[model samples]
Target: MFESLKKKFSRTSEKLEEELIEEAEAEDNLQEESGSRFSFFSFGRKTDEKKEEEVVEEEENLLPEAEEIEEVPEAEEVEEIPEVEDEEIEEEPKEEKKSRFWHRNKDKDEPAEEAEDEEIEEEPKEEKKSRFWSRNKDKDEDEEDVSADGEAKGGIFSFVREKTIQEKHVEDILFELEMELLQGDVAMEVATEVVENVKENLVGKKIKRSNDITEYTYYALKDAVEEIISIPGKSMTEMIEEKKAQGEPLVVMFVGINGTGKTTTIGKLANYYLKKGYTPVIAASDTFRAGAIEQVTYHADNVGVKIIKHQKGSDPAAVAYDAVEHARAQGKELVLIDTAGRMQTNTNLMDEMKKIKRVSNPDLVIFVGDAITGNDATEQARKFNDAIDIDGVILTKADADSKGGASLSIGYVIQKPIMFLGVGQGYDDIMEYDPEWMLNQLFSEDEEIVENEA
Candidate 1:
């Protein structure tokens, strides 16, 4: 029956999923671009380092080798060298000058050769060690930089990283959903509360896969609705049993505006309890409205239950009081009081309804609302509750209510449980309200698809 509301919720989930997935994809693309830029710079720097290393290695290779000193002549060559020197002695000044030059050259060559040998031994070793250390240090630094970059960009396995839902990702989508809910006849506060609850549940949640988005969205919506419909209180059946155990009838008064099937719902309840082995008496307490007494009497007669009713223009409160006394005297297990339908703004009728409540002192006051009225039903329930604290609700014409706004919001807005739903026109058409059933109706995949097709 809640086709419109169901579609709204389903569309909201889908929209949120699409928005989040799009955001995630965009982020992945941005990170990929960043990683590509980083890789490009890294490649360029490596190429420059390779070129510099090549130049250094080439320079090292072209360095001249240490010069070898000439070995001294053998003993025979040494004697010939002495004879040559004696011949050169004829030019004594020239000989002395040449000998001194040779001695000076020999003395300088020895230290230069030793220094050259030390340089050859230590310089290449030191240079190679320095180059090796510098290369290793640079390699380590590069590795660290790449590691940091990878982490910052979500690494090579970026797809495995979970996406955390953010407020920004869902804000606009939720706002739209709220507007749709309001348009669907959901009460303003109820719509706002649902949106806030969903946001609280979704924001900061982590999703590991694409399917997770759908799953999380579904549950978030489901939970919010569940909380909205789950009013903490005893069911009507429980109250009946409790009162029955105490050997007293359960007094339940039904109140609502006109044309909400209030009297029909009362007849339904009477038949319902009658079948359950409880004798229920109907009280025609709506003596103000024309034909109200006859209408209630018809239902009571049709259901074969005793009705304590008064003539039109009589006191509704006195009628209710007499009905309660009749139930007590007859030892009936249930009392269903039907009050005249009155607009909440009508002070005289509202006060008269309150007088009935005061005189009857019903164990449970039920608000009968037309599910088709949507937000109007909710507002009526609120005003009725303010006048005389209603204990529960009965949503009539629920089977025809496709929008389902009143059914979803009435209980939550008034802080009362919806005790029953009138699904059809038969005397047995009413069924006890079930929160789980409503949830399933909204979230079941097959049902959703079927409704969409219709």
Candidate 2:
């Protein structure tokens, strides 16, 4: 289904992831330098504190020497005093000694108090330094917490912005992705939409600890593709059954450009209903082509179903009217009408198609397309839909298309459900369309089983 797209995206992811990891590593190196600078600042502050403590210790050692010099001078003064004033001098010395005793005690108390005050001041300084380091640690921890929070916010579908994904890298990736899509045959508008979606998803988003950048990118790609192809509509079988319940034979008109297997798809559709136990009638309204009637008649004979057709150059609308009338008379449950293949730009042919649609009043107008034609098929589908307002689509040659971009873009571009796929060349080669199944075929790998299935 989308095998080519998957391989292309896988290569892109590997390339993008390699670049992002390199950038992240460079950022980590810068962070390491910042951490080293903070450590150096802390070391310098510790050295300054050590020098101040050494100065304080030297001042304490000088205090005792200065006190001894003062004591020697006081002793000499007592010896020089005369006998007449010996008693007074002795009393003076005693008074001096008493004052010295009181002064020494006060000096002793001052040293103890100064030491106590220094210890008190040093405790707060140590506490302040501890708080400074603690704050730095807390800041680092907070950064980690924020990254975790961002991952939580993104959950499984998106990524939250915490650590910025480099915009330059994203732009580069988008450019490469666009080129790849174009090379794979995706329409230009669809390619641009895909790139925009991926950019919106990944730019500025935080990379989770448990996830990789490549993972985020892959999610965005898958989401964008599924959104593009998954048009909201009723299931094919359900619509058919609903129309059947109305008690009128369900008429489906198939339209497409030449060589798109429109006639073969109608035959397959008729065979499909026959297996389901419903009477089917084939209408060969492609009477303009040389062997269109013979082609449809061959399918009718192979499937053992009734066919309403006319000679070449007959009115296609008249052929459709006869087919519906025959179905109602035969109590048939389904009518598969094959119209002539013509280019959408052919005004005359387009008008003829409109007449057939008006005359038949088909319950469903289906546009058959070739998956191998890629953008050409999509453009044709758009033109046909614009002209005749098709209800759904049936894509032929799906198995042969390696790129398969048309199948991915048609439904989204035209806002129509793709009802079936022509996988091979047989009446039983057709399969009901399943969006999930298509996705699985595109993305499923052993390593990505669940996500690819999704």
Candidate 3:
């Protein structure tokens, strides 16, 4: 009897479960269609219990079936409705996994340490990159016109090459050249320009041999000389002929700083005149210096020429006047007056030289100059030219160490021909100063052997 009650009770519960599910599904469907006032989950527990008791009562009163109903399979009893796993299940697992991973990885901080290490390494790299770019920016700009600018290129190499004085020792070469130019009395502008030009040429050059350096210096120096001395001047023969055609016995004079061979030049000129068959009469007007007259007299005797003499401290103008007078009386073709060697800038002495020229009324006034006076020689030539309108230059001491370097300036400024040269101490030392010969002497590489041949 108890077993039958339990069976009735289990069947009643199963029927109630099915009815509740169906009712809930119907209510859900009705809500979707009619916009229902209440949800299916709002069903009360007391109403559901009452429905269960009624289902049990109806099950017991049901008549016995004539035909048996096929039993539902066991698999169908747990009807799989997508084997529903909650989406929240996945969310919970993801959250649990994240927390567990964080807890486990907390002790293994190698990833964070590696990231810090990467940052530290990157900091120095960035700094080094900034420095490298900063240093090479200027060189990069220079290399933009690489064909034209042969300078240090970009990078640490350029800095090292330029600052460290490692560009084939160019800095040393330029430094030494600067010092040498200063000692040579080169003008600051000229010297600096030369250095700049040469530096521009050599900035990026890779000169490896001594010969290249030597050639470079040679060209640089040669170019400077050419720049200063490019002007052409009057020749001594041209001046003489021009004056001689105008009149007989043109008066040629010598002027220079003392000990610049002014007196000796007068003698050499007389000898040169004798060779030209011009009857030369020497004027002994340099009475101020001891042996000035006697020295000229000795040259006169050797060259077999006539000379006019006066006592010491005599008026030079009077001596010149007498010499001119003697030339006219004897039909002497040329009169070379030996004047006193005085500072060309001295006012009184320059006045005296002017007076001598005025009284003599010379057809041509030849300015005998020293070729080895260097820069001062240019100044001397200018002073002498300003004094008496110098007709030509007789550059003496051409064989000296200075090698007529001053001729370029003197000749260029005077715009007159160089007439003669005093190459040595003797008579044969006196030779016609040829322009081409002088150019060779000035620019040539061969050693000039200047003995006292005269």
lDDT of 2 by residue, 1-454 (tens): 5667877776666566556645655556211111111111122234446879999999999899889889999999989978888677568778888999999889877887888888888885454334422222444332332221121111111123224576787888789889988888888888999889988887877763214565676677777887877887776567667867887788889999989998888888888889988888988899898988998899889989999988899999999999999988877888888999999989999999999999999989999999998999999999999999999999999999889789888888888999899999989999988887776566544323212211
TM-score of 3: 0.51
| Model 3 ranges off by over 4 Å | 1-179, 185-224, 364-373, 402-408, 413-417, 446-454
Query: Which regions of candidate 1 deviate over 4 angstroms?
Result: 28-160, 450-454
TM-score for all models, in order of appearance: 0.70, 0.68, 0.51
Candidate 3 per-residue lDDT, tens place, 1-454, comes to: 0122112212222232233333434544211111111111112222345779999989866743522342445456557534445565567889899999997788586678778888889886554344432322444443332221121122211111111112444455565565555445344444565556656654454332222233343444445445544445555556657656766666766667787877778877778778876788988878777888889888889889998989888888888889988987887778888888888768888888899888987766777666656667767777888878887777777666352345544666667766666779987687765554543343332111100000
Prediction 3 global C-alpha lDDT: 0.57
- Which residues of candidate 2, in runs, are more than 4 Å off? 29-163, 208-211, 446-454
Model 1 per-residue lDDT tens digits across residues 136-232: 2344333433332221121211234677889997899899999989998999999999999999999999876444565577678878999999998
Task: Give each model's whole-structure lDDT.
Answer: 0.79, 0.75, 0.57
lDDT agreement of model 1 with the native: 0.79
Angstrom error at residue 274, model 1: 0.7
